[model samples]
Target: QKEVEQDPGPLSVPEGAIVSLNCTYSNSAFQYFMWYRQYSRKGPELLMYTYSSGNKEDGRFTAQVDKSSKYISLFIRDSQPSDSATYLCATLPGGTSYGKLTFGQGTILTVHP
Candidate 1:
């Protein structure tokens, strides 16, 4: 299996829906979990970062990690059309590979009017 897997969601939601995006990883050696948001052709912007397992919340975005299950998630509280973007989950391997990231294919999210 690939080290990481995620649905490439073109998930559409109404103006204030709660949106959930997720990914799964196979390697136990991954130490850092991160979420990134990208728009059009621009590079991704870091949205959340967590070491090991736990949850981190910032404004409309919340990220959760479960090391035991090798799963990670992102939750969007107040979805808006302006919030529409591709969400990518990434991880860095432990030890020497800690700075290098492996990314999921990314989920394309669209918040409709």
Candidate 2:
């Protein structure tokens, strides 16, 4: 089983709403984390990545990680319908095997206008 767990949400929100996505993991070995957004019929797109405990913001999106709690989060400000997609969280332990990653069951979100 994957070490990471997240709510498999078909989450719906109004346009301009603030949307929050979260994940938790049991593996203390995981040292790197990333979030991806996938649109229908398309491969997952890398949205953001975090390597340590802190918050990283890019425009309207924010990714936060707390290693002490083994928690990770993504927040979207002023959400838009274009944001509709399946979001995936990925984790990797720093090692030679960068190809090996544990992934959470994706959370689907739709922002309605």
TM-score of each: 0.95, 0.95
Error of 1 at 57 (Å): 0.6
lDDT of 1 at 30: 90
lDDT of 1 by residue, 1-113 (tens): 77989999789999999999999999998989999999999999999999899999999999999999999999999899998999999999767533688999999999999
Candidate 2, 3-111: lDDT as tens digits: 8999998899999999999999998888888999999999989999988789999999999999999999999999999999999999988663555878899999999
> Clashing residue pairs in candidate 1, if any?
none
- With a 3 Å backbone cut-off (N, CA, C), the pairs that clash in candidate 2 are none
